[model samples]
Target: MSFIESHLGDARQRRRLITGIRESLRELGLHLSLLNRQVSSRLELKDIDVDCLDLIDRHGPISPSALARSAGLHPATLTGILDRLERGGWVARERDPSDRRAVLVQALRTRNSELYGLYAGMSTSMNQICDGYSDAELQVIADFLTRSAQAGRAAADDLTSG
Candidate 1:
């Protein structure tokens, strides 16, 4: 039987498990978001701005439209965030070689290294928190999270389309 089906055999137990899962998901999301905001605020960036930075880091020299799409942000809003990053010397906009009309934004070399260092430190701390879990357990947790995120995205799409 499926994991969910197995866990949801009894109505009362299923209700309790579902409630606990929902509460944990909510608390984890809020805590992580708030923690990221606090850390980024110290570096003079808002949560959205930090997300923009992360997108750039993941896909360097990407177009503004592509960045906005990946970040789930509007093009106009992303333009504003890029403007701030540019002014802060964290990123640079260059003319796209293939398309003169399009601009490709990339993180500055020095800035990229600094950001990578910060990410490494944060990752280390996060990993430490899960160090008690066995590798198999972590893998299971990752799989569950991936499936949950996929479902959540589908639901969001349905809502928006409807």
Candidate 2:
């Protein structure tokens, strides 16, 4: 028999692989959606908003132009995000003490604490998920996934830049 026929000699093996792939895709989609919902519910922030917050928390206060560059978003898009965040009282835009022409976007103290707590909780849960894996297994998985992501990004870039 041919290699393909020998390996998938019966219909059952092919069916099982197809089913496994489908289930994995569904589970991944559901997991990401659920994680997004949980985070939004707990912190009253969307993914991009939280990303901006995290960036500010790490890099200190920054101007909207700098934030847009770092976040790979347009200045106009970042302005809208900043507007929503400012309106929610999570962040504020103030005139830069050193540069009167530039406004610095900063997180409010109370919201900063809230975001930190949520981050800590998520980190703990993620650590727990990897608890059962060996260091080598974790490294392999991480490497594989990183490569997969890079490949996907390259494909997208090709399509967009073409």
* Candidate closest to the true structure, highest lDDT: 1
Model 1 over residues 51-114: C-alpha lDDT tens digits?
A: 8887787798899998877777779988899998899888899999999998999987777665
RMSD of each: 4.5, 5.0
> What TM-score goes with each of the models?
0.77, 0.57
Q: Estimate candidate 1's alpha-carbon lDDT, on a 0 to 1 scale.
A: 0.83
Worst 10 residues of 1 by lDDT: 110-119
Task: Give the Cα-based TM-score of candidate 1 against the true structure.
Answer: 0.77
Clashes of each: 0, 0
lDDT of 2 by residue, 1-162 (tens): 998877776777889887996688679768866776677777777778877876776765888888886676789988888887888888888999998988998877876666567568667887898998999999997996788668756876676557
Q: What is the C-alpha lDDT of each candidate?
A: 0.83, 0.78
Best candidate (score: TM-score): 1
